[model samples]
Every structure is written in C-alpha cells, then in structure tokens.
Target: MKTSSPNTLTEKLKSRVVLIALFVGSMWAVFFLSVALPFLHLNEHGVVPRSLDGLQGILFAPWLHASVGHIAANTSGLVVLGWLCTWPNIAGFWRATIGAMLGAGLCAWLFGAPYSVHIGASGLVFGYAGHLVARGYYTRNLVSILVALVVVSSYGLSLLFGVLPIYPDVSWQSHVGGVLGGVLAARAGAGAANRVRVR
Candidate 1:
C-alpha cells in the first residue's frame, strides 16, 4: 500500500490550514470593508422576514455582521468547529457549510421579526456543531463519536440556549434551522458512504 510521505502529509496539512484561514479571512475582510464604507449598508442585506427582497439574504447573511462584537463571537466558533468538520475529508466540511448556510438563512428569513435584519455567522457555528454531533450518531464510528462527545461537552449549553427565543435580538430560528440542516447533511453523507462501501 502506498503511504503518504512526511513531506506529503505536511503539505496536505498546510493546505487545509490555509483554506481555513482564507475562509475566516474573507469574513474579516467583509467586516472591515463594511466598517470602512458605512454607506454600503451591508447589514441591510441580511435576512428580512417574509419579504421578497430579503430572499437574497439566504446567500448573503452568513457573510454579513451587525457589529465587531457580533463577528468576534462567531469567529471562535467558526475556527474551531469549522476545523473540526474537515476531519476525515474536506468535502464534509463544505457539505456542512452549505447545508448550514441554507438552513440558517431560510429559517431566519421565514421567522425573523418583521422589518428586522438578521445577520451573523452564529447559524453556521451552530450548524457545524450539529453536523459533528449528528455525524457520530449516523456513522457510528469511534473517531466521529469522540468528536461528537467533545462538541457536546464544549457546546451543549450554547446549542441548547441558542435555539431558544429567550435572548432578545438573537436569531434562535436560524440556530434551529442550522442544526436541522447539519443533521440532514450528515445523514445524507453517511448514507452515500454506506452505499459506496456496499458496492
């Protein structure tokens, strides 16, 4: 069997790290640009409840933020949880991200307060947590199970409270939708893997 050489492994790791950095860097870039050009009013592009014009937010909301504190809070979760999702394969990370974005954005659009603009990456963070936990349940693998345990231990409270409407200005709808999307993505990915193995 061919095995990856030390250099090859190092290169692959570096690539993955660079990719994650680029992803996070883009978010920071958008935030900084928005701050520098307030006339752009990027926040207005966020999900607006039940409005035709707001539908665009499903694709844009995750990249937009209302404030520095908002993005700062999401940055840690994205770096950590996003990195975790890359385990085993990078495709899983993209799948989880797309699923989370769609789920979170749609939920925020459908249920957000009238005329309120919902923005931030919190939904993606929640989606990553959901994907990790659900991947364990669906795959029943040791690595996945351990990762899920770690996620639950570290983020169980946030997952629980984030989906609740107790916090004013918080998008609990997006949180709930993100988890649903993540779980669905995990299940679909597991099923595809299973089919491939059976062949």
Candidate 2:
C-alpha cells in the first residue's frame, strides 16, 4: 500500500539501472578475469561446508561462477529479479542482496555435503525472486503482487525444481537459504516503501 510519485519513481528507476549495471558488470568482469587467469583457481574460493576457511565465501561466492555457462544461466534472473527488488528502492535491493548472500552462504557452509565447494550466483537469483514474491504478499501492494504473480507464472516451476535435492550438481541448500533471506529482508523492510506525499 505504498506509492511513489512519477519523479521519485523515475529517479529510483535510474538508480536501479546503475545498480544493476554495476552488479552484472562486476560479475562479468570477475568471470573474464578468472578465465584469463586460470591459475587463480577462483572456483576454489566458494563455500565449503564446515571448513573454517570457507566462511569468506559467504561474501565472495555469489560473484564467482563455475563457468561461463553457469554465470549465463543466472544472468537473466539476476537482472530481472534484481530490477524488481530495486523498484521499491535501492536500499531494499541492498538489504535483500546482503541478506540472501549471508543466508545462502551460511546455510551452504553448515548443511552442504562434506568436501563440497558450492559456488555461483544462483542463490542470489533465488533470493531476488523470493524477495519480490514475498514483498508483494507482506506489503499487500498491488504492483508488487502483480510482479510476484508474473514471476511465479514465468519461472515458478523452474524455481521449484531448483530447490529440490534431485539435482546432484546444484546446491539446494543455498536455494532454500536464499529464499529465507529474501523473506527476512521483506519482513525487515516492510515499511521501506510506504506511501509518501509528493511535493
């Protein structure tokens, strides 16, 4: 039940465009650099469950991908869902992102299989989707709700499958954690986008 004026909305949109650019651009940059410098073994930096060293991955894992294809698969969701998250405000986007990152990494570290190193932006993608969907329900905003419906219609089935343990190669734990994080963000920022008077 919050509304933003045309000018405020425009500014928010513009800010989000820049935020997304920096986001995707950073991902691409890291991927290219990792490819260029194979010896860096960037993939090794991902979260490894129960390992003290893996804790750092909580902050770095989302920026690292297993391969070009992996990052490509997450690119669309990151852009689209990320955009929707920012539609409310850049602060909300950051809140969701940080929460998801921590949630996914922590869960993967704690619950993932031993000797496994989980990596990729998929957790963040799931987080973005979760935030948008849950934000609608929590805030009861028509636009947010519509965006949620559209997301559910477009990627609901796939999202459902991603969280299943059937996929050996995927870290379903991360997916679950990411979603929980998004929901947490929505709850934390419930009043972040409340209706405001336009001057």
Provide the overall lDDT of each model, using Cα atoms, as 2-decimal numbers: 0.92, 0.89
**What TM-score would candidate 2 get against the native?**
0.91
lDDT of 1 by residue, 91-133 (tens): 8999999999999989988888999888888999999999999
- Candidate 1 versus the native: TM-score? 0.96
Off by over 4 Å in 2: 1-10, 191-199
lDDT per residue as tens, model 2, 1-199: 9788999878877888889999988999999999999999998999999999998889899999988899999999999998888875678889999989988999999999999999998999998889888998988889989999998999899889988899888999899899889888887777544533221
TM-score of each: 0.96, 0.91
- Name the candidate that leads on lDDT: 1
Provide the clashing-pair count of each candidate structure. 0, 0
